[model samples]
Target: MSVAGEGAGVDTGTYRHAMGRLAKGVAVLTTTAGAQDHALTANSLTSVSLEPVLLLVCVETDARFHDAARESGVFGVSILAADQRALAAWFATPGRPLPGQMDRAPHHRAESGVALLDGCLATLECDVRDIHPAGDHSIFVGAVRAARLAADPKAALVHFRGQYSALT
Candidate 1:
């Protein structure tokens, strides 16, 4: 077993464990194709540009959210508040039945038909501008179609060391 602070190991297990230490803001990525909706817990969101308003999200290529988002050509990202850990966990769980998967949480539909979970600190709806395959995931570059930022200050739910933490 490698101890903490040990030499950097490039293996998959070692790389994953090392990345776990990096704190990332939590967000639920939502998408819909036709009559069905899909969502997944993702922390790979990053702001790429402000001019023209652009952002990116990395989704596992095999994830259900991926296909829906790809086919729909749009996606929604709801930045989770610290108090919304339960909702985050719910979407992250695999094998959860669909058609009513989003029923557990109250949400509203964006203009693009993507569902944005209510009570989030921030939300963004984007149209997929570009897609790049990266390893086992796809990097989706989105052009911000609509966005909302919470007016009041609040804590954000974060993920670190493979666990969720409220960063106050």
Candidate 2:
């Protein structure tokens, strides 16, 4: 069985192209694993519930940061500002170490010891409560422990059609 309509095989390129049309706010997801910090550029974060303040983030199963976030049981989501395109690119690059990425941009540690990007439009520190396996990714459902908005909330970094955009 394939994960496509009517049992048809899903074309990877087509799926990527179709998904690219959906505009979404960019966020840098971060977590600390042991002595190392891990981060990834993500746009797949969304709220799941309000009473318990549950949210979910999708992480590729093969990504290095996936294990780090799973092991730590905590993650921080920094909603990127329009001017933070470079920071997003740095985190999205494969084989880029967290230290090297930090050299390009600075971040702070939350009370939970999760790495948080500075100058973001908003931030959320979450504690993982459950994980569900998706096709090629794992959906991590978490409870929001803390959240804050940036001092400047003028513009938000958005991604659409495979490019970075600003929604001011």
* Clash tally, candidates in order: 0, 0
Query: lDDT by residue for model 1 over 1-168, one digit each (tens)?
Result: 336765555687878889998999999999999889999999999999999899999999989989889999999999999999999999999989977999998899999888998889999999999999876899999999898998884899999999999998
| TM-scores of all predicted structures | 0.92, 0.93
lDDT of 1: 0.92
Q: Which regions of candidate 1 are displaced past 4 Å?
A: 1-9
Error of 1 at 147 (Å): 1.0
Q: Which candidate is the best by lDDT?
A: 1
C-alpha displacement of 138 in model 2, angstroms? 0.2
